[model samples]
Target chain A: MDLSAINPTLLLASLMVAATPLLLAAIGELVVERAGVLNLGVEGMMITGAICGFAIAVNTGSPILGLVAAALGGAVLSLLFAALTQYALANQVASGLALTLFGLGLSALIGQGYQGIKPPSFPKADIPLLSDIPFLGGVLFRHDFVVYLAIALTAVVWWVLKYSRIGLVLRAVGENHDAAHALGYKVVRIRVAAICFGGACAGLGGAYISLIRVPQWTEGMTAGIGWIALALVVFASWKPWRAMLGAYLFGGITVLQLNLQAAGVAIPVEYLAMSPYLITIIVLVIMSADKSRAPAALGRSFHASQ
Target chain B: MKLSKLLATAAVALGMATGAMAEDKTKVGFVFVGPIGDGGWTYEHNKGRLAVEQEFGDKVETVFVESVPEGPDAERVMTQMALEGADLIFTTSFGYMDPTINVAAKFPNVKFEHATGYKRADNVSTYSARFYEGRAIQGHIAGKMTKSNIVGYIGSYPIPEVIRGINSAFSHARKANPDVQFKIVWAYTWFDPAKEAEAAKVLIEQGADIILQHTDSTAPQAAAQEAGNVYTFGQASDMAEYGPKPRISSIIDDWAPYYIARTRAVMDGTWTSTDTWDGIGPGMVGIGEISSEVPADVKAEALALKDAIAKGEYHPFTGPLNKQDGSAWLAAGETADDGTLLGMNFYVEGIEGTIPQ
Candidate 1:
C-alpha cells in the first residue's frame, strides 16, 4: 500500500468529524454500563436524535438548538427503556431491542415531511493562532464547536470517573448493586440517570450527523453508527479516554480506506469499504482476549431481591 | 316480509355497482424503498407521483408509504396497497423487483409498474432511464475542466443502474483525455451525507479536481465546494445552491412526462405491460442549466454531446471497450445490449479495482 498518498491533515480532520458521533455515543454508553445498565438500543436513540434534530433545525433554523433538541429527544426515548428495565424489571436485552424498533419507527413517521430539505450549517470555530499553523491548524483547530466539545467531554468524564465521590458511588453500583443499595446509593435512580446520559450523548451524536455531518434528514440516517459506538465502548474497556482513542482509530480507518481508493491503490473498493467494520471486530476480539480488562458486571442484570 | 326481500335485492344491486365504479377511479399507489426526502432516487419518484396526481386529477387518486425496506416488508406493503384498491402501483427500486413480481401474482387484477427492474408478469410492466446518457455529459464536462486528471465518483451500490453510470462517465472521460483516471468509492448506501462527504473529502485529498455521484444527497456537492477547485454534478436534483463554487451541471430527473403518460395510458385503457427505458431524447432525463463557471468551450462541447445523445446519434456505451482484464469486451462499432448492460458485473479496462464480492 502507498501510504504517502494519505493526507495526514485531511485525514485528521475527517477523523475528528467522523469520531464525534461515536465519542459522544461511547462516552454515554460507558456511563450507562458503569451504572450497571446495558442498553443495546444506542442505534435507536441516535436515529431518533437524527430525525428530531433535523426536524427542529429545519423549523427553527438553528443547528445548535437542533442538537439540544436531539439530545433531549434521545433522553426521552431512553426513559422508556429505563422504565421497563428499572421499574418493571423487564429483560434489559429485550427492552433495548424494543427501544431501537420504536425509535426507528417513530423517527420515520416524524421525519416523513422533513425529507429533501437541508438544515442550516454549523459554524466552524477556528482556534486563534493554532488554526494558522499550516497542516496541523486546518486538521485540529478548524472544526465545528461540537468536535471540541466532544473531546472536552472525554476529559471531564475521565476526571470525574477517576476522582469524584458520585463517580465512586456509580462505580460501586456497577460492582455490586446490592452492596451499593445497602450503603444508601439509590441504585435504581443512579442507573436511570446513567441511562438518560447515554441516551443524550447518543442523541448528540445523531444530531451531529443530521446537523453538521450530513445536515439533512433521511431514513436510517444513523446507519449503524450507534452499533459502532457500542463496540467502541467495549474496545475501550469502558474507559472514557480510551473510548475517544478507539473512535478516532475507527474513523481513521474509514477515512484512510477511501483515500486509498481515490489514490488509485489496487484494492477492491468493497474490501476497503468493509475494512473499518472488520478492523473494529478485530480490535474487539483482541481486547476481549485480555479478559482481565473487561468490566466484571458487563451485560449482567442486577435486582434488589437478589 | 315482502318489503324486506325487496330492500335486500336493491342493496345487492347497489353494492355491485359501487364496486364496479370504485375500480374505475384508477387508484395509483407507490411503494418506496427509502424515504421520499432522500433528495435523490425516492424523492424523484415521489415527484413523479405528484405529477401523475396533477395530470390526472379526479381520474386518479395516489397514495404512498415511504421507507419500506426491500424484503418481506415490501411484500406486505404492496399487498396492503393492492387490498386498499390501488388499480395501478409503481414499485420503485430494483430490490422491489421480486416483491413486485410476488405481489403481482397475488393481485392479478392490479397493474404494477416496477422501476429500474426487469422482472415482468402478465400484470407487471418495467420502467427505467438511460441515466448513463446524462453521466456521459457529466464525464465530458469533468474531463475538459479538471486541472488534475483524478476524478472522484461516489457510487451507491454495485447494482447495474449505478454501474452503468460509472461506465458511461468513464467512457466519456477517456474519450476527452486518455490520462483521465476515475476514483470510484462505493458508499454502499443510497443516501447518507456523512459517508458521501467522507468519500468526497478522501478523493479531494488524493488530488481529484472533479466529482460525480450515483448516490443521493447534496453532500458530494457540499464537499466539492468546501475543498475548493473541485467540481461536481447534481445527481437527482438541481443542487446548485449548495455548490456556488463547484456545481457545474446537474442531471435532473423529470418524471412528470412519464408519470403523466403512464396515467393517460391507464385512463385510455391502453396500458399494456412493457418495459420503457426513456432518457433525454424523450424528456424523461432532464439536464439542468449548465453553470457559468465551466469554460465556454467546455460548455459547448458538453452541449454538443448532449444534443447528439438526445438525437440518438451518439451512444455512450459504444465500441472499442474492454473488460478490466484487457480482454475485448465489445468490438468497434458495437453497442452493449440491454441484457448485458443490465447484468453488468465487471469493471472496464481503465478501472483498476475489482468489484467487491
Candidate 2:
C-alpha cells in the first residue's frame, strides 16, 4: 500500500463536504433536545427538503431560492408534529415517527414530476486570498457557502450554549420542564421554536446534498445521514464543538476508507465500505460504555401537568 | 301536465351529456425505483417513456411516479395505476418483480412490462438486454490496455443481472491475458454518486488501472479522470464527454425501441407475455464509440470480439467455466441456461472476492 497515493488536502476537503449534512442536522437536533423536545423525524424532514429544494430550484432556476423553499418545506412538515405534541398532547416519540412517515409519502408525491431534471448548482465562494494560499486554499477556502455556514453555525451554537441566557433557560426547561413552566417560561412555545430550528437545519442539510454534493435530487439521497447526525449528537455528549469534531471524525473515516480502496490497498472492499458505520457504532459503544456522559433528559418526555 | 313532461325531458338530456363527456384516454403509468434524474439506469428508462409519448402523440397519455420504494409501496402504486385506468404500466426495477406478479394477478387486463425481471403472467412481460455482452467488450479493452493487471468493478447489487456482467467481464479478461485479476466493490445501491465515487477511488488505489461499474452514476468516470492514469467504462449512459483520459467506452441501455415496440404491439392487439433479451446485434444494448485514446491494435481486438458477439458467433459466458471455489459450473462447451443466469450467485474462477450474503 502506497501511503503517498492518498492526498491529505483532498481528503480533508471531501471530508468537509461529507460532514456538512451531518453537522447541519446534528446542530439542529441539539437545539431541539436542549429545549426538552425529542424529534426523530430528521430523515423525513431531510428528504422532504431534498424534493422541495429540487423542485423549486428547477422551477425558478435559482439555487438560493430553492434552499429557502426547502427550509420552509421542512419547517411546515415539522409543525404537524409540533401541533400534535403541543396542542393535542400526543406522545412525542410516536408523533415524531408519524411525521417521518408522512414526510416520506408527501415528498414522493411532490417529487414525481421533478425527477430526471437537473437543478442549478451552487457556485463556489472562493475566499480571494485564502483560496490562493497553496494547500490551505484548496482545503478551507474553496467550498460552497453552505459548508462555511455549517462551520459558522457550529461556533455560534457553541457560544450560545456556553454563554447566552436563552440557552440557560432552554437547558433549564430540558432538565426540569415542570419547574421551568412554573417560572412563567412557556414550555411548549420554547420546544416548538427549537423543533422548527431543527427542521430548518435538516432542510439545509438536505439542500446541501441536492445542490452541492450530488447536485441532483435522487430518492433517499440523504441515505441515513440524519441517523448518523443523531448518533453524532450522542457521540459528542450533546456539546456543539464536540458534535463538529465527531462529524469530521466520522467523515474522515469515510474519506480514508475510500482513499485506501483507490490507492490499491490490499483490503476487502466490503470491509472498507462498511468501516464508516462500524466505526460510528464503535464510538457510540465507547461513549456509552462508561455511562458518565449524556444529557439528563436526553430521551425523556416532559409533561407540564406533572 | 306540460310542466312535468318538460322536467322529465331535461333530466334525460343531462344524463346523456355527462356520459358523452366521460370518454377515457389511453392511460399509461410508470413505476420507478430510483429518482428519474439519477443520470444512469432510471434516467435512461424515463427517456424511453418520453419517447413513447413523442411517437404516439395524442393516441397515448403518460404519467409516472419516481422513487417508489420496492415492496408494499410498489404493489400499492401498481394497483392505484390499474384502478385509475392505466391500460399499460412499466415497473422499472428488478425488485419490483414479485409486486408486479402479485398486481398482475389482480389486473389481468392491464399490460405490465418489467425491466430486468424474469417472472411473467398473462399480462406481464419481462425484458432486459444482454448487458454482459457490452461488459465483455470493456473487459477485452481493459485486459489489453491495462499497465496494471488489476481491474475494478463497482457493483450495485449482488443480483443475477449485475453478477452476470461481472462474470462475463472477468471471463473475457482472463481469456485475453492469463494474469488479469478483478477487484470487486459492492456499493449496495443503484445510484449514490458519493458512495460510487468512493468505491472507484478505493479500487484505483488498490492498483486497478481499469474500472467498470454496474451502478447508475457518472461518478466512476469522474473519479477515474481525477486519478489521471486510470480508465473506466460508462454504465447505462454514453459518458464519453468524461472519457478518453478515463472513460473509453460505455454500455448504453437503449430502451426507446423496446418501449416503442411494446406500445405498438398493444395498439396492434398482438401483445403477449414473453421474456425478451436482446444485445448489440439488435441495438438494445448500445456499445458507445470506442475513444481515440485506445491503442489502434487494442481497439481492433476489442471490435473483433464485439463483431463476433453481435453476429452470434461468440458467447461471453461459454463453457469450461468454474465457480470461484474451483468447482466446475458448466460442462465443456456448454453455455449457461437463462434460468441459471437469472439466479446467478456464484463468482467465476478469476474473481478474488466473495459475494456477500
Q: By TM-score, who's the top model here?
A: 1
Whole-model Cα lDDT of every candidate shown, in order: 0.84, 0.82
Model 2 lDDT per residue over A1-306, tens place: 556757777778888888888889899988888777778888889888888888899899999999999888888888888888877878888988888777777876887765445567678899999999998999999998989999999999888877998888888877777778899998888888888989999888888777667665555667677777877786777778778877887877787876765555777767877887788767755765664455556556656776
* B1-357 per-residue lDDT for model 2 (tens digits): 899999999989987774354344466789987667666788889999999999998777788987787789999999999887788899999989999999989988999999899898899999999998998898888888788898888888778899999999999888888899887767767777667766787677667899999988776776677668999887898866676667788899999989888888887789999899999999899888889889899888988988999999988888899998999998788888878888898999867756765
Pick by DockQ: which candidate is best? 1
Q: DockQ of every model listed? A: 0.38, 0.23
For each candidate, what TM-score against the reference? 0.83, 0.74
Worst 10 residues of 2 chain A by lDDT: A291-300
Off by over 4 Å in 1: A1-3, A36-41, A47-70, A76-145, A158-163, A171-183, A215-220, A231-242, A290-306, B1-28, B55-63, B70-88, B102-111, B259-272, B320-334, B346-349
Candidate 2: stretches off by over 4 Å:
A1-17, A36-159, A172-220, A227-306, B1-23, B319-322, B327-334
Model 1 achieves a DockQ score of: 0.38
